[model samples]
Target: MKNKSGGHRRSKSARNEAAAGNKNGRRRRNKSARHGATADDGDRLSKLPNDLLLNILERVDTLDAIRTCILSKQMLNLPTMLSQFFLSAGSIPGHHDKACLFSCSEVFRTNNAVARVTDNILCTRNPKIAITKLKIRFILMPHDSLTIAKSVARAMATQKVGAAEFEIRTEKDYEDCSPADLLQFAKQLNNFVGACWDTFAGLTRLWLCNMRFGELDIPNILSTCKLLESLHLTNCDSGTDSVLQVKHAQLVELQVDYGEFDRIELTCLPKLQRVIYNYWCTYEDPLYFGFVPQLSKLNLTKTGIRSEKILELSQLLANVPSLSDLHLDFESEKIWVIPECPKLLTPVLSKLQHVNLENLPEGCDLAWTMFFLEAAPFLKELCITVWDHWCIMATDPEFRKKYGFCQKADVNWKPHVPDFKHKNLVKLTINGFQPDDGFMEYIRNILEHAVNITEISLYDRKVCGSCGELAPEIKDKVCPSRYPQTDEERKQITEGLGLASRAMVHFRS
Candidate 1:
């Protein structure tokens, strides 16, 4: 009887100890949860591998990366080890917009910020780690520029910099500057580039704005950049109405925005893969494609037409057979691309996989877009966004008339391949969706033709760029979306479209 009593006492003691341990574990887990992570997770984050920590820091600005990891000493060391650095001329405190560059003192301060940031980073970096990429954008000032160029030159000499980029800007915006200002800006920029030939030669990318260079000036600049891969020209050209010819051996991407050129002829760019041109109307034919075998993506955005010609895609992309992505933004104006016969378009769009048509006018017939489905047999996805952007749009009647902006008209079209069946179209997304006859009919027609379609996304019209600063008078300009909200309405539409799975149709609330 004494032995049994002793065994019972030992068992009771063991139970009490287990209950105490459970209470302690719950307390620790609850405490960790309050900090938005478990204790184990916090330790793991602090002890992450060096490569992973560097990858996280490299995505943000150099200053932002430092602030995020302010608590971790190990993390603080990782910023110096990042392979790529993108530094911009810091903006003014109250004047974050580029329009504020008109202030001379503020512009000088911005230039100083660029020099200050570049000096701090390049001068005190970890020399053992090779910098693979470095991009710096700053205003054009002789004094500050000299300081920046010296720092970059020293860093390049000491480190194995794989690529460098520079974005040069002036004090005033392109529209705000006079002809004399533009000419002077061009001279300053030209001198800057000339002085930094060694620095620019190693540049993989370059961006310069508000420069009116001579006919041979741009070509001479290109010659100095022997290893340049990407060139961005903004509001720049040789003459008021001159033909700009580009021939670069190593150039892979070209972007021309608001350039004052009658026509741009890409004579020979062997490695060019992407091209983006915006707000160009100086000539009937905005561009002439020449010897760009590897070109796969092209983006063209135009607000209103000042040219005398309607663009034909078949002819524009006649040589680009490897094109996989094409984006066209009409700025809610007249549609520029001509829907030609399938035979004429199929060769140009043969390997095209993705197509995005943005800012189509609301009243236009969606049937005109069917031309792509019939032409590009390999197209995998098609997205369309229809909206009239108000903020940037010209609303004054007199200004609209001067630019020849016409009334919103429908583009008449009839499918050349009336019974054509698409086998590769996998998804369709429409942003400006409405549950009306026109929309429903178009969707039903698509369902019938796209036999392998899996997902159809419908979303309300999204205000791009800025939605916060809306004028009271134009607040009602946004058209209310009529997308079905109730589950029953959605079900009816789903059944009406004959989709087998409700999961395949998505309605973004």
Candidate 2:
């Protein structure tokens, strides 16, 4: 939610585009250095057999690969015989990346080029050579999409394609696009999907960006995509506070980023394994799980001010009993999740093995996190990081008050089981560790609770250059952190934890 990558990793098309951008005249010199000093280094590299050259070509942008093949007569048939193609309209020369960054004409021209090149390859490729992968990232332009979608549908019909994917992007980013622009983009996308339903049916992954789609538009698209295993919706929403009810059988993963829905109700996804929801606009609980039998991983990230009701995991994840991995990121905002009693949470979090709590506000109590230990009986690792992220934090007093920011204070929590001896907790990691009396006592308290713990790692506060230095007024409000560095200090800290436990405590600098 707070600036995390929705795309799991950089796609092949993005990597290829970056490589194509940096492939200058220095390539031959580097090639010569690698294959021994020789003047025929470039030729030697290019003259390799088709199989070896094709391997290198496939690693680069499809346009550059085509150009490389066009430069050599012997490699003319390689483009036609290639098994993979990743074409991105945004990567076109002087298109979205160059001086005409926001020019609509440039966008249209680049999309046309992408559609043309995609058609030339998919429509003319050899039938004997099966396409192992086909990916296209193009703008949602009407004419260009029609051409690209029809070519893709034809390729899917004529060629045996594996892992077919589409990453649809609007000409303008979500921040820059207006309401009319978003509506138009969604209309164009609907037309494209309806026009090329066959192409979308073969897609294994689809990422949509920047659209205010109709309430039913999303469900209709999902119905057409029978084989889609993953779907990502970024900055996409319907009207005011619409309830998003999803029921896809084959979807294995789902990501919703900054969506403006009141709540997402997972009706029936029997095969879903992972879900990531971030920065929802609604004040209610973000999700309700209904029938996700195989789901094991859930990551919920949000930045909330005060007045947002405490999120109760017991009710939200009541139906998702199979969850084994849980992560909650607060984005340095107010504590949102209430420390529910163990009896209520343990039912849904029974299989949970790992829990990561990130960006807990500095100076607040760590005692609230022990609720997880009391609840998830099978949990093995508990990791939490405390920091004051100034990048997202407003320093002005008026601005902070207007947004209803909570003052830095401890979260009032009392452990339900004061004498709880957890046997399954094997490790505990705390970042932003301090050597103060309260912090050290907190460590002692943890050692007393998790008697079976094997390791306790204490790390210094992570540096955030992007956050810069906090304002002078705000800096004084944060808790002073002085980690034990010298031997004497370490000895005193260890001695302070006398008779707590035998865990190997490491003071990681």
Candidate 3:
């Protein structure tokens, strides 16, 4: 009996030893599976061609591209092979956390990261590989000046960057910060400009925004970039009172938006094909365009036209003999109320094909429209967007009270009757179409005059949700439709006017 019991105990111990071995084997298999999975991922990434990897990196922001360098050995050099680099504080990962109330510590950390990343990129990048484009946008801080300057200098030093953009924005509005503080930031930009002029020999496109010019002559600054093709200056301020002048031989496209200058003169832009000028603030002087024979497209947005110099616009149009597409937006209604003046010899735009006019004030006669239709005899398309500030005021009670409803007046002034007939006009689009007396007269004039008109598209004026009360109501108010035009109304408009039988009128909601 004792022998049998001892044998049973040995059998139990053997079973226990078998179970322990099985558990150890399972652990070994699991660990191997985990390691194998990681290796497979790494191998897949490493097997990709260098060019393919570089293409992938270029699509992301520079900060994200840099982060991939730590992911695997294959991606370590991918950032260096990129042809374009875009570095902005807004692009930094996790930097937008509570952005509006960003703290000082967060700023310090972001600044350090920016400096480190930029320095590493400039220093580690292969000299043979050329960076074709570089853009940097950041809020200028006191400690950020030197680092940004160095980065810009390093980029320009390559002598191969074809397009570059640099923008310095403030954390707060200009009104919130003192002028001295802003000037201090502006001083740092001078270093970047120096680097640009010294090394930007291959640059073709350059855009600078929100930077202080500080008595620096813009014309002289642009002269250094001999190869620049497109230039855009937005909200750039200069402390000097001198009229800003731009003259570039190689420039093809130029856009100036909301500058602090009193006047801007464009002279000797021989190759310029397109020019966009947008100014809303009050200025006594007029914009001057000179010797741009190749200019084909000109867009003027929110430009102020003084009551006295209305004739100057006609003279300015004489300079661009080749202008085909013209867009004009007057700043105020005062332009429409000019007094009786002697007939001026307005230049004819024989090549003008398309004309777009925006913010056509109420109660204004169609004299301006007549001016263009007479000048552009070959106009193929005309689009007019009517000005209705009442739509905006309907949203805010305070604004509505401050700026009362636009007072309607009788159309008393008669413009020069044009003997010219428009034969080439095919399409006309009028947005914000109200069936007021002025609009009716405008449409009648077009239908009677444009002999070859093919189609007229009329769109109801847009209004905010708050302005529902002020919107025009149909006579049959039971349906409660906004901008309802009945079949009877269309019949009346088309019957009297000698509209072409082939011409179709469309009313868009």
- By lDDT, the best candidate is 2
**Residue 136 error for model 1, in Å?**
1.1
Query: Which scores higher on TM-score, 1 or 3?
Result: 1
Q: How many steric clashes between backbone atoms does each model show?
A: 0, 0, 0
After superposing candidate 3, which stretches have Cα over 4 Å from the reference? 1-60, 64-78, 91-116, 122-132, 140-159, 170-172, 177-185, 199-203, 209-216, 280-283, 303-311, 331-333, 336-348, 390-419, 462-503
Model 3 steric clash pairs: none
Clash pairs, model 2 backbone: none
Give the runs in model 1 whose Cα sits over 4 Å from its true position: 1-59, 63-82, 92-107, 306-308, 464-477
**Error at 223, model 1, angstroms:** 1.5
Q: What ranking of all candidate models by lDDT puts the best one first?
A: 2, 1, 3
For candidate 3, lDDT tens digit of each residue in 1-509? Answer: 24655753446655676677777757877888877866555566657788887887777779878887667876777787778887766622222343455465665566567666776787777777777777765555555645665665676676456576554555544445455654654565565556545434445666655555666446666777787888877666574344677888899998877666666678889999998878634344446778888999988776332223343445666577788898877542334322332243234377889988876665566545656665566889999876544433233446434544233333344445554567999888888766666676787788666888888888876444544545564222222223438877766555534454424777777
All candidates: TM-score? 0.84, 0.83, 0.69
What lDDT does candidate 2 reach at residue 39? 64
State the local distance difference test value for candidate 3.
0.64
lDDT of all predictions: 0.82, 0.83, 0.64
